[model samples]
Target: MNKKRMLVSLVTGAILGVFCIVGASIRSGGEASTSLLFALWYNRIIMGLVIGLNISKKDLPSIIIRGAFLGLVVSFAYYASTGFTDIVSFLAGIIYGIIIEYVNFRVNK
Candidate 1:
């Protein structure tokens, strides 16, 4: 594994995670519960990190597949822990995964 690539992924994931939490906080007008807020941040960070760690190429289809899978896994875990599931979270994770992979592609290119 490329250490530089992994580093890039880590930073990218962290930034994306922060943005996800911030956006949610804004959208909810700070009304979101502590548990929900934590969950959102946790999900995004883990998803981003996973994508960054695993994504090794620039192929769109591959990126989409990996992202979708990672998102599903994370979302499922959250559901198992909280007994809550939502399509939005699953979709968001996939989207974030794609974006992270694309960014990595661009950077590495």
Candidate 2:
């Protein structure tokens, strides 16, 4: 949680966001781009690793429960972005959240 680490994470995350947007847009026609895959993969893997590393061993169950809720929240969070243009994207968030959270829980345990 140091300022330097936080800054690095923030910058990386923003960059990834850009890649996601670009990748998803171009995805309308062709096979998915490597850059887009890299962005999403990096975010999920690293973020999950970070969360797993920080979770308390004894509170694993509670932590997992919270993570589940977070996934649900993320699904809901996409409503604004996909509400008008792509309901599938919003629905995918729910699945993404679950998969990401499950991986985090497994790694952390």
Give per-candidate clash totals: 0, 0
Q: What global local distance difference test value does model 1 have?
A: 0.69
Tell me the tens digit of each residue's lDDT in model 2 across 1-109: 3343334334443444454555566665656566644544454334433433343333556655655554445435434533445454444444444444454445434
- Inter-residue clash pairs, candidate 1: none
Give me the candidate number with maximum TM-score: 1
lDDT of each candidate versus the true structure: 0.69, 0.46
Residue pairs clashing in model 2 are: none
TM-score of each: 0.75, 0.42
What does candidate 2 score on TM? Answer: 0.42
Compare the candidates by lDDT and give the number of the best one.
Answer: 1
User: Measured by C-alpha RMSD in angstroms, how accurate is candidate 1?
Assistant: 2.4
User: What overall lDDT, based on C-alpha atoms, would model 2 receive against the true structure?
Assistant: 0.46
What's model 1's lDDT at 74? 67
